[model samples]
Target: MKLLIGNRNYSSWSMRPWLVLAHFEIPFEDEVLLLSGDGWRETLAARSPTGKVPVLIDGALVVPETIAIIEYLADLYPDKPIWPADLQQRALARAASAEMHSAFLGLRGHAPMNLRANHAGKVSADAVGQDLHRVETLWGQLLARSGGPFLFGAFTAADAMFAPLATRIRTYGLPVSDTSTAYVEAIYGLPAFQEWLALALKEPWIVDDDEIDVIQGRVARGTLA
Candidate 1:
């Protein structure tokens, strides 16, 4: 199996299934395409159906979209348990992951994912506040139900889905309660996340326009606190 990913420092979509694969200790070759280059476009167009990053290529199958890739991995490695075993828990996890894939436009647009950049305490707009509220509410509910650490008491696909959101929370210093803060801390402390950050730090590809705005002191040296 092979996974095609985008810039390690900026590609949130690439991070999702990559993290899932990492968590399961799946061994697969990776092809990293630096974004903003014609080479990236050509590579994606030649390989992926949607011309996007984070496409999974198996023996004779191609999986696009982060969730689909995750589900495919889960199916292939049921013993690895990409999702919770309980039917209800699994359903909730799927719902949460899907919600993340579709909703939170305000936060997504205002605070794009840049793992190497740090823009702590930078609130974008009024709508951002509402988005944060919704996220925190969901986080609080999940944590309350599962009781600690990860969203489902152990690392699962839902947590992987929201990992980028956790990055955004830390990057923008979004308003979050103590419980939500703990959840974010749990995510950042994961071994897979640590490895991802280490690789991102070493990456040389820098998209100048994607650099977090410094005029408002939102980003400091491309990393958040």
Candidate 2:
């Protein structure tokens, strides 16, 4: 299998399925497609049905979208515990992952994941406060129920779905409860996430659209080095 991903520093969507594949010891090769450059969109279009990052290519099958890729992986490896074994738990996990896919626009808009940079206190609370509250509530309920270092008491695909949100919470210095803070720390401590983070820090490409400083006019678009 070959997974085509965008730059590690800025591609939150790409991070989700990659973590699941890596953490589960799945045998796969990855190719990094720089998200910027002349004709990059055309390149993505040619390679992906949705013209997006994180497309999974397994022989003749191509899986696009993070959740879809994760579901496909879960189906491929039922013994791997990608989702919880219990039917109810699996349902909850899928629900949460789907919610992650569609909701939280405010936080997503204001706090793009950038593992290589920190813009502490620069994000306005008003812009993301409602979404933060929802995150805290949802996470708190799950953690309290599961007694987790992760949502389901182990690192499942549901946790993979929220891993980038964890980065956003930390990178933006967003205030979350002790529970959520611990959850974020747990995500950072995952061996797979650490491997991704290490590579992200080494990346030279910058997507200005995702850079808070560039969007806020604090840094010129092409000046980051």
Candidate 3:
């Protein structure tokens, strides 16, 4: 299998399946496209049907979209315990994952993921602020259900789905409860996630659009630590 991803620094969608693959130790070739520079759409369109990163190419199969890739992985590796063992838990996890995949536009817009830097500040927009609060509520509920370290016990696709949001919350220093803060820290400390973050810090390319606070004259954090 060959996994196509965008630059590690800015591609939140790419990080989802990438995290799943890495966390589960699934073997696949990694392909990266620099999201910056000329004709990025043309470049992506040539490879992926959706023209998006995090697409998985498995011999005859060509899969696009983050959730699709994750589901494909789960199907392909049925014994990996990619979802919860309990039927109800798995259903709830899927619901949470789907909610993350489609909803939370405000949080996503205002808090673009940048693993390299931390820009601590309040999100001024009413919608974005509400989104932040909603996330806190959601995290608290999920963490309570799972009882720590990950959204679900023993990391699953659900955690992978929300991984980038953890980075976003920290990067923007968006307000989160201490429980949410602990969850964020636990994610950051994951070996696979830390590997992604380390790679992101070393990338030469940067997306001007994702550099939201820096462009607006806020002090940029020097490290992801």
Better of 2 and 3 by TM-score: 2
RMSD of each candidate?
3.4, 0.7, 3.4
Best-matching candidate per lDDT: 2
Position 181, candidate 2: lDDT: 97
Estimate TM-scores for all models: 0.91, 0.98, 0.92
lDDT of 3 by residue, 1-225 (tens): 999999999999999999999989999878998786789879998988987787899999999999989999999999997888889989988998999998899888877888887677745556477777877888888789889788777788998888999888888777678998998898998898998899889998867767775545563643212
Model 3 sits at a Cα RMSD from the real structure of: 3.4
lDDT of each: 0.86, 0.94, 0.85
How well does candidate 1 match the true structure in TM-score terms? 0.91
Q: Residues 1-225, candidate 2: write the lDDT tens digits.
A: 999999998899999999999999999999998899899999999999999989999999999999989999999998999999999998999999999999999988989999987789999998999999998999999899899999999999999999999999999999888999999999999999999999999988879999999988999998887
Instruction: Provide the lowest-lDDT 10-residue window in model 1.
Output: 216-225
Of the candidates shown, which would achieve the greatest TM-score relative to the real structure?
2
Residues 157-188 of candidate 1: C-alpha lDDT, one tens digit per residue: 99999998898888877777999899999999
